[model samples]
Target: MLVFSDLEDQSGIWEETKDLFASDFLYHHKLTEYNDEIYLDALDDIQEHVWNCGGGKITQYGLPPSRDGEKTSNVIRREKSYNKESLQKNVNEKMSLLNDKQRHCYDVVMSRIKNGCIFNSNGIFLNAPGGTGKSFVLNMLLDSVRSQGKIALAVASSGIAATALHGGRTAHNMFKIPLMEYNEIRTCGIKKNSELARLLQMTSLIVWDEVVMANKNTLTALDITLRDILGNNKFMGGIVFVCAGDF
Candidate 1:
């Protein structure tokens, strides 16, 4: 994966076979497990290409056939996948389960999502000990946002923690952050025109679990990438970034 960070250092054979880079990466890492949404966009592109080559017209299932169709489809698919009624019910039921401390954290995060912070913090750091129901509160927050027809991303520093949340993925895979730190320009691999970028742009909230397990450069890279992709100067491109972990 580090080879993706430096084009100049790559060998001549790698440069000639650069078109297979994505396929190689996917084949080796099995990214499809957690990265289905982005891969769906790629499938759309492939189908479109085959249709054009075979002189067949592109058909739309739920998405348009325009240039940005895949991006729109991915966003709409994610938005519609949530059962609003069930999510709202879950949120309501879960709210009562939150203890005083957890309830306060929930309220603070939801409020930040509703009302922008004056200092542009747009970040909520929850420091708690183990067995404090941090995951419970995080799920409630995710449900609360999704219930309102908004997009909330659940990601974690590690895959084990990711499975604890609803529709969670590893933060590195979700953001396309390089596995190994390269140079100082620390930036994620999300192209501005890709569906993944569109997803991030539409994201209202992001819950990152076990955040302390991640390297600082990972977060820095995400910050820089989000600012560029979302075209916002605020922290995390003004997205509600929630970091929860046992410290």
Candidate 2:
């Protein structure tokens, strides 16, 4: 009766030891009419089991395997798991060295996320030249939000450029934008009630680099697709977009 979603939660220990964690969640909780106390207690037990499976508390689980057997890269995008403690440790080390300007930018964006005003703010753009540390700033922001258990997407116009970002994928690959030459209007490759659409709805932040390389059609396509998926007409379907590039 127990079921755990590999699609939404981060993959790693959670997936490896899902069998061990499921007995309680899929069976006991249902039998008890979905008791919170029981669920929390089970989580405690499951956490201990997960720790023991990894050779006790001292061992590290490390990163996930990079086997893209299906080439369904969405699995990685939808389930980006990071070592929260280790990620925080790394981000802190990086944050300490930021220049005053970088620090200011980080603080402002972090403030928006923390204050929960991101949706209200509409969007953000880290307008800077190549040497101005735009990528560093963006990485810090992504790490900050991710550490707080929020989803942040990283995309770029080019595959090579996307590699430098966290969970970064080409915007076309991730969004599934159509490549039609004769089309007057455009729509994304996302289908209704599909996994990509679900992920888009759940995403809290999107950081797209190399925006200048994309055309107005691409942006319009994204907006139209989002409107379709999110059922709204507002810009970017009311999601906060952080589009950047050398403009």
Candidate 3:
């Protein structure tokens, strides 16, 4: 039969048991003798419990049955604490600089980060006639994320507009996107190079400005090329894609 004492003492016991399970076969044999069925049952139960508690699982062998529950609980607590710390760090870093709207947008973007959405792919349609401070908002967002030690790449369809963003450059120059116009199959020959591929893989954020100017066909090609180059075009280094354009 299995037994648990007071919740607090049980929790403390688990912490110590977790270490024993890390190594030492004596505990493993003891577990087998105590209740093999419960032992196997606990593995799945603990995994689910930990996950529900916002903790991930780690596997280990040669542990006693008495230690399993405590070990799992401790691991779950530790993971939860660690994630809390990371989130606090990110928030504290951004708190001072972001204003209201920017803070809202930043929160939305950061959700992807917390949810493990790695392919920083997002389309921001800034539809407020020309000169509505859209550019200002974009710049602020970029600076905020960069200040948190993330790389932000800004690319625009036009050279002049790209320069206006201060730190931004032409999409062609930044991503090396082919200049082939839509419907012209062989206009821009495909190049088999790894430099741009590597950059895409490592880059955290890709801000494509003036996306409205990009032809549908060109956009399709760019998407396909990026998807091909990056094994998973979902999220790049926890980077977010913020596209600011006038439509």
lDDT of 3 at 175: 57
Residue pairs in collision within model 3? 14-70, 118-235, 119-234, 119-235, 120-235, 204-239
lDDT of 1: 0.72
TM-score against truth, every candidate: 0.70, 0.65, 0.51
Q: Between 1 and 3, whose lDDT is larger?
A: 1
TM-score of 2: 0.65
lDDT of 2 at 99: 97
Mark the regions of model 3 whose C-alpha exceeds 4 Å error after superposition. Answer: 1-102, 113-121, 185-193, 233-239
Sorting all predicted structures by TM-score, with the top scorer first, yields: 1, 2, 3
What C-alpha lDDT do the candidate models reach, one value each? Answer: 0.72, 0.67, 0.52
TM-score of 3: 0.51
- TM-score preference between candidates 1 and 2, better one: 1
The clash count of every prediction, one per candidate, is 0, 2, 6
The numbered model that scores best in lDDT is 1
Cα lDDT of model 1 by residue, 101-180, tens digit:
88888888888888865545898888888788888889899889988988999999999999888877899878888766
Candidate 2 lDDT tens digits, 1-247: 0122224334455557645544544442224354344334444444444444442221223323222222232333433444467567768889888999889988877766566444466567778889788888788877877777777888999999887787678988889877666255488888977767887787767888989888778888898999889896767876767787888
Alpha-carbon deviation at 146 in model 1, angstroms: 0.2
